[model samples]
Target: MTVPAPAADGLPTRVRIHEVGARDGLQNEKATVPTEVKAEFVRRLADAGLTTIEATSFVHPKWVPQLADAEALFPQVADLPVDLPVLVPNERGLDRALALGARRVAVFASATESFAKANLNRTVDEALAMFDPVVTRAKADGVQVRGYLSMCFGDPWEGPVPLPQVVRVCRALLDMGCDELSLGDTIGVATPGHVQALLTALNEAGVPTPALGVHFHDTYGQALANTLAALRHGVTTVDASAGGLGGCPYAKSATGNLATEDLVWMLRGLGIDTGVDLGRLVATSAWMADHLGRPSPSRTVRALSHKEQ
Candidate 1:
């Protein structure tokens, strides 16, 4: 595939793509992946020039059996030169990640009450309360903590999540010592306008654009559009999965995340630097798709790999 000519449209010169294939991408798989495969996936993503790769969650095995080997998996990829951030669901999860020498960790929170209850069995406030110490202790240990706020756009149980409701949870996370926040369109119901509006509201609510990341789902085929809106608003960090590999296991309506290959294609066309080699990224996703026994859902992956064949 030919690279799109550089076009500067007043966007950030460089965008950080948080690769989530190893963790969020494979978390919901019904079939268990070997620990070695998961480790190799992380290695390949880093090799593709992704700096920050979410490795694995420290959540309990019973809840997510696919990542039961977190202890075994984390150690194998701990020596990589990239930023390997793991998900820590609570204080105990934080302890688990810290024990394995994880320097960066993330906590998942919900912007709406229904998703809070469905995912964590806690109220909105109760869930934030759960993460208070997780963020506190992680910061105390000098670890970088990223707060993930899901259902920022729409919820399955609740139709449209209010802008203020999402802003409140984001504020709570930052106030609790989270180094940054990732706004998640859990059900993928966000549009470019909604994304811009929310970012503006958060800015007004004292959330800096630099401290924010956007995670969009492609359920409505709006992930890239929503992402462009964020970029125009100065959001430099974006969360995406290789080969479109993730969905909310808790939210049935949620679909695969924004494909990293697709996002890179867009950024490259726009003259935004992401340090990613598109050829290598597509190959990695194709390799992963082969391992999963399915064709990659990423359009760029399909298009480029098909021409190679």
Candidate 2:
């Protein structure tokens, strides 16, 4: 696939692709991947030049059985030359990550009430409140915190999420010491116009574009287009999973994330730097697809891998 050249003005010259295949990608898989495979996936993602890789979630095994081996999986990739940030659902999870010498962590909250209760068993406000102490304690220990706000565009239970509600959640996360906020289109219902509008609202609400990351799901095949709109709006960080690996178990409409290989292909063609090697990324995703007993979902990987990926 070819991407049009980015306009000489307005678009960012560089973008950061936060690889999440190791964590978000596998978290919802029905089969429990071996810890070794999870570790190798992280290693391969880092080798593909993804500086920020979400290694694993520190949630309880009963909640996400796929990531049950988080403790073991993290150590296998700890010494890699990359920033590995694990997801800490609460204070206890934070303690577990800190015990393993984790330098960066992420906390998640939903922008809608239903998802908040379903995913975290709390109200929207209660969910944000749950993260406050976790964010504060992590920051005090010099650990970088990335806050995630899900259902930014559409919700499974509640139709369209209010723009102000999303902005308020984002602002609260920023104000509570999150180093970065990842806006999640959890249902993959966002379009370019919606992305631009939300970013505009965020800027108007005092959130720095630089401190934001866009997490898009490709359920409607619009993740890349939405991402382009975000780039034009000055959002430099994008969240992607290798081979389009991930979906929200709570939001059935949502599917895999934007594939890293696809994003890298577009970025390279646009003359934007991501510091990632497209060939290596495709190879890694193909390997992961092989492990999952299927072909990679990435169009670029399918085209270039040449082995029926």
Candidate 3:
């Protein structure tokens, strides 16, 4: 298939960025970021033209103590012009989120049993079953739900996952009324070949490609390559974090999600318009990295800063 040419304006006409830095990014941090800092980060992200930001998770504080402030923080930024989605681990988490007037929530699952058990404390079937009530309740309450499937490419414990397993979970999520499904390369082991093959399998199974999204970590530095493969298959929505903010706690040495600035830069180069200001996003990422006392993991940020120097 011939890749489409760049737009007349020298960018793709559109792209969607789901910012998870605030929630997934900070969830594993050793230090608890003050509520004010989290709020400020969300506000700055909105100002950077991000329409979908994963603000926080409402799971039990014991599992992820960093996001214990979801309730307190949601109300403070309820007026922002963006979909601030919080991760809801179960019905109880859903209840907390609903109390805070959450309009969007995400449910997560894993393809492998071991990862599922370690991360979500359930088997694959059990985890998907848990979402039934959560999705139903969220839909009834007029809240949109997004589904996430981790270990789409390969699992650290289970090795490479079967294509049918990924397709089945995806179909289940979509059938359960999830607005979208984000296929995650949790350990960053997906290659362009695997991406193409899995997407093809998903499409053949009657799944709508547009309703599918890809989330790649740069552990193997293949996030961009996998993204290109997804785009080639007409997959529209992509999940990325600013400054490359999140990593898998279960997999040591694994890097965070694909960087938003880098993703935006690539999309712009391919003529896709993400509606994000590249320079502003880079600056915001830099500021956050500084505030967090760590240099950004984004190659785009490093390159741009180097160019300026």
The regions of model 2 sitting more than 4 angstroms off are 1-7, 307-309
Residue pairs in candidate 2 whose N, alpha carbon or C atoms collide under 3 angstroms: none
Model 1 lDDT-worst window of ten: 1-10
Winning candidate number (TM-score): 1
Local accuracy of candidate 1 as per-residue lDDT tens digits, 1-309: 556666577789999999998999999888998998899899999999999999999999999999999999999999999999999999899889999999999999999888899899999899899999888888999999999999999999889998999999999999999899999999899999999999999999999999999999999999999999999999999999999998999999889999999999999988889999989999999998999999999999999999999
Off by over 4 Å in 1: none
Each candidate: RMSD: 0.8, 1.6, 3.1
Each prediction's TM-score versus the true structure: 0.99, 0.97, 0.95
lDDT, residue 4, candidate 2: 45
Error of 2 at 270 (Å): 0.6
Angstrom error at residue 291, model 3:
1.2
Higher-ranked by TM-score: 2 or 3:
2
Can you give the lDDT of residue 113 in candidate 3?
Answer: 90
Show pairs that collide, candidate 3.
Answer: 11-271, 11-272, 12-271, 12-272, 12-273
